[model samples]
Target: MANFFTTALFPVMNQYFGMPVTFLIHGVICLVYFFFVKTSVPETKGKSLEEIEKLLQKG
Candidate 1:
């Protein structure tokens, strides 16, 4: 669904902003999304399943 929407919208975005601006817009959006996910997600390296389950259950 998202792919289709982006595919359809890319032409309109490119038409108004041109290819270079469109690519820059996408790159910025990807970087922002990456940072948001990286900060918001929890890290559970080497944690046991029971410990992970307890952590999730607390929420």
Candidate 2:
């Protein structure tokens, strides 16, 4: 959304900068995704389906 608006609102943005604002936003998003996966995204660290269901019900 921010990228789209940035490009659309500033007509010369793509011409002057190349690869539209979306490219920069995409790069940032990719960096964040890599960082998140490296630091936070869990590795399916859970138990069986039945156990998960039981815990969900208790919660």
Worst 10 residues of 2 by lDDT: 5-14
RMSD of each: 2.4, 6.0
Task: List per-prediction Cα lDDT, in the order shown.
Answer: 0.85, 0.66
- Best of the candidates, TM-score: 1
Residue-by-residue lDDT tens digits, candidate 2, 1-59: 75586557455655666765646866787698789888764443568887767766764
* Residue 27 in candidate 1, Cα distance off native in Å: 0.5
- What overall lDDT, based on C-alpha atoms, would model 1 receive against the true structure? 0.85
In terms of lDDT, which candidate is strongest? 1
Give the TM-score (vs. native) of candidate 1. Answer: 0.68
Error of 1 at 6 (Å): 2.6
> Candidate 2: misplaced stretches above 4 Å?
1-18, 42-59
